[model samples]
Target: MSPLISSFRIAIAAGVLSLFALPAGAAELSKELSTAVTHAGLAAGSPDLKMVQTHLHHVVNCLVGPAGAGFDSGQANPCKDQGTGAIPDAPADKQKLLLTAAALAQGGLAETDLAKAQAAATATQAAIKGAE
Candidate 1:
């Protein structure tokens, strides 16, 4: 298989594995995080519009999913401005995503960066009341 195809497959597999790694009972948090991890995996393997878009959505969701889902952190909501939801629809958001995708496509993110992103997601989820 071509390198792209191989990378895509690897990304897909990584997503599936992430789901199994999550602890039970945090269904809501886990779902979004799993999706984000999946998208990140895809970008790491091979960047593309779809993968990057999805990656941003999930990453943002990871940071804001609890608030969007109404977890009520009490201190201050991370995704309060999100209102109903947050999708990368704005022109600027799109451009940023495209740029990120291109950069990732050129060369996947560093392992440390990926790990930091993953850790951020976990911390964000923990911040939400009842999300952990």
Candidate 2:
């Protein structure tokens, strides 16, 4: 397979695995984050909206399945599991900052929202500078 196709297959597999592994409540949070990012990108008129939407769709699909059914309210409540736990309540501020960066990247707002985008990007970049 082509490198691009291979990469896509790998991503799809990972997303499926992640969804199956997440606790019901944590899965909802993940879906919410994906939705927020998509909406923010749309609001920003992101040039890469299609790519962002694809990624978000993959995420939601992986977490919620093909049916697109979101977690029920009770199942969506906050609760963190140990080790492989889901962050039931995702940190709102951090998610906002990350979503801002995603919007800037997708919207190509780097040129238009230069200062704001840069600042947000810098902060988001710092937050994930190192990872395992």
Candidate 3:
């Protein structure tokens, strides 16, 4: 290849890679956190156990984003386009809260009982409320 063409190709490749490497910005992370809290609240207030689980799944989806583990395509992504994943995008100081919230949301997913799931949802909300 000509030197100029090789250099152009390298620049294109670097630009593509940079897009994936950059972390979510503050505005995107904030939107994700707020959406997660809303999903948790919805789970807690759901009338049926199935709906509770569904909403809890939404919370998990929001926290983890499409690329993170525990993301469920079956559940709607409330935080889509907000960030890569709330936990992954979170600042170092705020990661703990997002992780706690994610754990609570996972627990809610595992719960068979309505009350237990609701409790988990409430706990999930509390854990992330401060970060939002």
Candidate 4:
């Protein structure tokens, strides 16, 4: 295989391995977060949703894998690293939005939190577009 293809395979393998290694709680959280993002993406029809989803997946891999593979892997935290050294001071509405996304990424919204889920989906769309 070409060098690029080989590298891609290695990365993919590493990501998969990482997911399997997450601590149960972190793995669960990551799953919820990933699900939320995916649902939101599908709802929003935003192309940048793919990029956000990829990043969220990497977060899961990092949590489950060797050191330097998860969100705390020295790379800035995407959720908190929104161009600020500190976690951005998102408004209550935005916090709900992110929480909903994280929840959805981890698992489907509970019936009571469906509104939050929709907000999260919207926030994800806006966040991705702003990043671009």
TM-score of each: 0.27, 0.27, 0.79, 0.27
Collision pairs in model 3: none
Q: In model 4, state the lDDT of residue 47.
A: 45
Model 2, 8-113: lDDT tens digits are 9999999989877967644555554444344333333334434333333322222223332442223222222211211224444444444433333333322444
What are the per-residue Cα lDDT tens digits for candidate 3 across 47-67? 889999998888888888898
| lDDT, candidate 1, at 17 | 97
User: Candidate 4's residue-wise lDDT over 70-111, tens digit each?
Assistant: 233543243332212111223344445443334333332222
Count clashing pairs, candidate 1.
0
Model 3 CA deviation exceeding 4 Å by range: 1-24
Question: Per-residue alpha-carbon lDDT of model 1 for 1-132, expressed as tens digits?
Answer: 999999999999999999787344334334433444444454434334444334434444433345343223432333333332222222342334333332332232222355444443333323221221
RMSD of 4: 15.4
Candidate 1: TM-score?
Answer: 0.27
**Model 1, 76: alpha-carbon shift in Å?**
24
Model 4: CA > 4 A from native: 1-20, 46-97, 100-120, 125-132
Candidate that scores best on TM-score: 3
Candidate 1 deviant stretches above 4 angstroms:
1-25, 48-54, 66-132
Alpha-carbon lDDT, every model: 0.39, 0.38, 0.89, 0.40
